[model samples]
Target chain A: MPITTCVFDAYGTLFDVNAAAAQAADDPDFPRLADLWPAVARDWRRKQLEYTWLRAVADRHCDFWQVTQDGLDWALAAQGLDDPALRARLLALYRQLPTYAEVPAMLAALKARGLTTAILSNGSPDMLNAAVASAGIAPQLDAILSVETVGVFKPHARVYDLVGAQFGCAKDEVLFVSSNGWDAAGAAGYGFRTIWVNRAGDPPDRLYADPHHTLGNLVSIPDLL
Target chain B: MPITTCVFDAYGTLFDVNAAAAQAADDPDFPRLADLWPAVARDWRRKQLEYTWLRAVADRHCDFWQVTQDGLDWALAAQGLDDPALRARLLALYRQLPTYAEVPAMLAALKARGLTTAILSNGSPDMLNAAVASAGIAPQLDAILSVETVGVFKPHARVYDLVGAQFGCAKDEVLFVSSNGWDAAGAAGYGFRTIWVNRAGDPPDRLYADPHHTLGNLVSIPDLL
Candidate 1:
């Protein structure tokens, strides 16, 4: 079958996780955060994804919200700066992250082209909803999916199965997009056509199938087909 | 029944992965390697482990040797240094990488106490055999196990099953040891009594289960039980 639907990874793909750290600059409590935020954000996102995979492998499922908080706490401790206010503010920022400017336009363009577009993420339903609504991109998406329904994280086959189940389409007919190369590899290995948004220019993850398409940002996604 | 068998993760736990890159300091071609080797080794090991997990999740299993080489290649590219002879020499160094100072004595103590000892690692059979023989610790082990039998990497339940299957013991009757906190978590989650060798003073991986015992190195393993 020809491609009929597009599924995106929520965190790094559709939402900018580092944007939450930018809010730290306004907080006088974290004087060093302006310079440290980038590394902290990277560590937090790495731990978040790692926790999801660890929990899945251990047969212990926690919502992505808890994982996100745990990841933030780890990142803070690793950086050796502890402030209750800064912690709370950073987490609050996560609930409403900024998106790539091309996100809404791309989703709209996909819909306009008659392609069904949805998000397939390890994020919790509440987290996804708040992020989508806060970014003003909720109205443009056909569906907002979360791993909570299945109680496992992405890169797991069952997580990918949720997309086909939702849209009633074959795996190959659903186009998967993720900024995370590991997630892209997993989706492609699961039989979806994957577009890896390598915004950071990292090497391809060598453990899984390579993504079908590679692009720098969401600006190129609408024209990917 | 009480724990009867002790299994160890080979690469970082028993053998020093960094030792290979340190050998590069002896090479005339890479004179700047002394300071660069540690960071390069860290990146290489990180990518190697990530590939193992990603491969396991993607159902695209390859032997650990390939993963190790792929990881080293990526680390080299990231460092923007390319030399075929340097790569070959580094890989050759891996087959006889240095072991922890206390490993042989600890294994001897376990044997003298009439406890069974073995190695449960992601290493390929040849790599494990060569390392154990070179370290003069092969006679100390009753079994040399690999993930090849299970076709997956650690943290996957099946890989842990290889240990129990070889020893004909229940999961709880086996004690697993690893320097990697993530590996310890997987063993604990799989129902084995775990000892995390925290030689680097790193924080525990905030993933799932915690190890049953924590020690600075193999020097503490014999006294653990």
Candidate 2:
């Protein structure tokens, strides 16, 4: 089936999840974080995803914002760094994560192709909105579907159901894109034509399914169409 | 309610998850793996749990043995090592992982107290059986429940339901112990009085619920009574 809708994951796929800590490290105020930010950012993103999956399986549904904070707290504690001000700054930065350099043109190219574009993310509505608005690509998106609507997280089948609910597209008629290998794999298992934008050249996740395509970044996403 | 049943997560809780890799590292035939084994073991365990949670959320059920191999593959590839012989050796070792020092005595202690002792694990029947028989703790355990029965992994509610189905015990009447902080949290959220065996002294997982007790090892488990 031809792709009718192009769906993207919000945090690491469209926005730079590493921006918060990287930005904090660059700021003159947080000198101590200069050497520690990368590890912290990696941990923050890892724990955030882990919490979402754990909560989903455990039937404990919470919004992404709380999960994000919980993740940051764990990341900070792991590093033995306990500065509340740094925590606040890192979270505030996460609220408006900078989009990748090619995000605007990539979304615009998909839109120009007359394909429906949207985001299906574990992010809460407020966080997704803040990110979309900050990146100024809200106009290009037909919908921003958050797992909050279903009170669960990916790679839950219900979370993937949001795409069909919003666009009324068949599973195979959607091109699901995510930077997370497991997310792409889950979408594939759910029967979507999936693309994994493997920015770090990480190995494919050992999951039930594999993405149909693997690209180095979103820059070539439009080309795949 | 008093604890009538004592259920433990088998792999890391009773069995030392690192034993396979650590043992492999000690073998003279694998002298090159001495420095690399620890990171490989950590990645293997992390990916194994991540796959379980992902598969559970995605509704793609596979046996734990496959998950174990997949995890080991990822870990091996991450370290840029590829040897079919080494891979086979690791899987062989995993089938008979050593139980923690205190597991046999602890189960014996629980049995002496007339508490119904059992294992609730993601391990498949054959794997769990192999480990149980190898450890000679088959006589100590009243029941061994695997997620294969439910076709999903923890911390799914259904996985926990197996405990009650087998033991006929109330959630509050069971003491759920796990080395995984998340598993402990999941059990706690499921209404079990949970104990987190924090052997590594890691911080508590930032989940909806927290384990009721934290201990350095399982040796003191009977002391709680």
Candidate 3:
């Protein structure tokens, strides 16, 4: 099926998830993060994703913003950096994360080609709005779907259902892109033509389905279409 | 309600999850693991639980044994340990992992008090049977429940349902214990009195529910009753 809609996972895919910590580390005020930011970033992202999956399975639905804060708390504590000020700064930065260098143009090219584009994320609606507005890419997106509407997180069939519900596209007529191997695999299993943007060169997850294509970045996303 | 049944998570609770890697590291043949065993064990356990949660949310059910091996593969690759022999040896060690020093005594004490004792775990039946038998604690456990019977992994309500289904007890009548804070929290959400065996001194998970009690080890479990 020719792709009619392109759905992207927001956090790690369109927005650089590590940018908040990386940005905070650059600030002279947070001297502690200069060497510790990478670990904090890695653990924060890992715990955030883990919390979503746990909540999804446990039937404990919460907003991704709350989960993001919970994750940052765990990550900060894990690294023994217990400063509440640093925590607040990191979260503020997370709300307006910098998009990947190619996101705006690549998304624009897809729009120019008359293909529908949307973000299907575990993020809350407000968080997604802040991110889209901050990145100035709202015009490029036809819709921004969050898991909050369904009261569940990603990899759940319910979350994926929002895609076809919004676009009126068949499962096969969507190209789902994500930076997470598990999310891409989950989308693949849900029958979307999936692309795993493997930014970190990680190994493939041994999941139920394999992504149709893997790319190093989104610069080549327009080419794939 | 008084606790009539005592249910414990198998891996990392009754059984020492790190023992296999720690044992393998002591072997002269695997010189590489002497210093790296802790990282391998930590990553392996984290990925194992993460895969379970992912598969659970995605509705892609697989046996815990498969998830275990998949997790091991990810951990090994992360540590740059690519030896197939080492991989095989690790899997062999995992099948009969050592029980925590206090597990046998702890379970026996609960059984002596006329409380129904069992293990509720994501481990496949065969794997759970092997571990239980290997630990020589099979006599103390009235039932060994595995997620394979329900075709789902834990923190899912269905997996927890196995506990009451097997013993014909009310959710409140059961005392659920898990080494994982999220698991304990999940059981709490499921309406069972929960205890989080915080072996690692880790921070509390900011999940929907908190474990009713926290203990350093299973040794103090019987006293709680």
Candidate 4:
């Protein structure tokens, strides 16, 4: 089926999840974090994704806000950093994660092509709103759907079902994009045409599902169509 | 109902997942992996659990063997190692992972106390069987259940139901032990009397389910009983 809607994952796909830690490197209170922030950010993002999946499986639903904080807690404790001020700064940066260089133009390109664009993310409404507005892409998005509505995180069929439910389209009519391999796999397995934003050049998962396209960045997404 | 079944997650609970990499360090092929093996094993283990959960959510079930290999693949590439010889050696070591020092005695203690002990794990049947026999814990275990039976990994209520269905007991009558905080939370949320091994001294997760026991090792299990 021809695609009518394009749904993107917010974190890592549109927003740079590493921006908070990268920015924290310059903070005067934790100047030494420059050496460790990269690893901390990697651990934080890993745990964040793991928490969402765990909650989905356990049937214990928490908004992405709680999971994000939980992830930051793990990251800080793992790195032996106990600065409350640093934690607050990192979280504040997370709420307004910077957009990737190509995000605005890519979303605008999709809009110019006469396609409806939305965000189907594990992010909470508040987090998504804060990010979209801060990133200055709010005017380009038709909808910002968070997993909070269904009380489950991504990769779950119900979580992806919201796209069609909100946009009034069939599952096949939505083109899904995500930097996360699992999200791409899940969306494809659910029958959406998936494009994996292979930002890290990671190998594809050996899982049953395969992404229809593996692009390096969001700017290339419009070209895929 | 009185506790009748004692189910354990096999990987980190009874077996040292790190031993495979540690042992591989002794191999003449890859001495350099010694310093990096710890982190590699950690990454491999992290990704393995992730693939299981992601597959469970995506409704794209693959056996844990493939998932294990996928995890290893990610770790290997992440560390810039591209040797097929090293990969083979690691897989061989993993197939017969060494058991934790306290595993046999702990399982025997439970059996002597008249409890039917089993392993309810995300490991495939072949993987679980090989590890059980190679680790010499097979004689003490009444059953070795794999996620293959339900075609979904743990943290899912259906996977936990295998324990009760096999033992003909209520959910509360099962005591589930896992070193993974998320698994402990999921099993506890599903009504098992969960004990988190807490091997790494990690802080408790803020998930809704709280483990009934936070013990340091399997040796402490009998004391808890």
Candidate 3 lDDT score at position B165: 90
- Residue-level lDDT of model 2, residues B1-225, one tens digit each, is 999999999999999999999999998877768999999999999999999998887778899999999999999998887888888998999999999998899999999999999999999999999999999999999999999998989999999999899978889999999999999999999999999998887777899999999999999999897
- Give the whole-model CA lDDT for all candidates, comma-separated: 0.86, 0.92, 0.93, 0.89
Misplaced by over 4 Å in model 2 are none
User: Candidate 1, residues A1-225: lDDT per residue as tens digits?
Assistant: 778999999898889899888888667878989888987898898788777876776567899999998888878888876888888989999999999888989998998899998998988998999999899987778899888888888788888999878989999899999999889989988999999999988766775578998999988777766
Error of 3 at B200 (Å): 0.8
Q: What is the TM-score of chain A in candidate 1?
A: 0.97
Candidate 3 lDDT (Cα, 0 to 1): 0.93
Any idea how many clashes model 4 has? 0
lDDT digits (tens) for residues B104-220 of candidate 3: 888889989999999999999899999988889999999999889899888899989998899899999999999999899989999999999999998889888999999999899
TM-score of model number 1:
0.93
Write the residue-wise lDDT of candidate 2 on A1-225 in tens digits. Answer: 888899999999999999999999998888989999999998999899999999887778999999999999999998888999999999999989999999999999999999999999999999999999998999999999999899989999998999999988899899999999999999998999999999998878888999999999999888788
What TM-score would chain B receive for each of the candidates shown? Answer: 0.97, 0.98, 0.98, 0.97
- The per-residue C-alpha lDDT of model 3 at residue A75 equals 93
Candidate 1: give the clashing pairs: none
DockQ of 1: 0.51
Using DockQ as the yardstick, the better of models 3 and 4 is: 3
Best by TM-score: 2
Query: Model 3: what is its DockQ?
Result: 0.74
Taking all chains together, each candidate's TM-score versus the true structure is: 0.93, 0.97, 0.96, 0.91
Q: Which residue ranges in model 1 land beyond 4 Å of their true spot?
A: B1-3, B32-35, B170-173
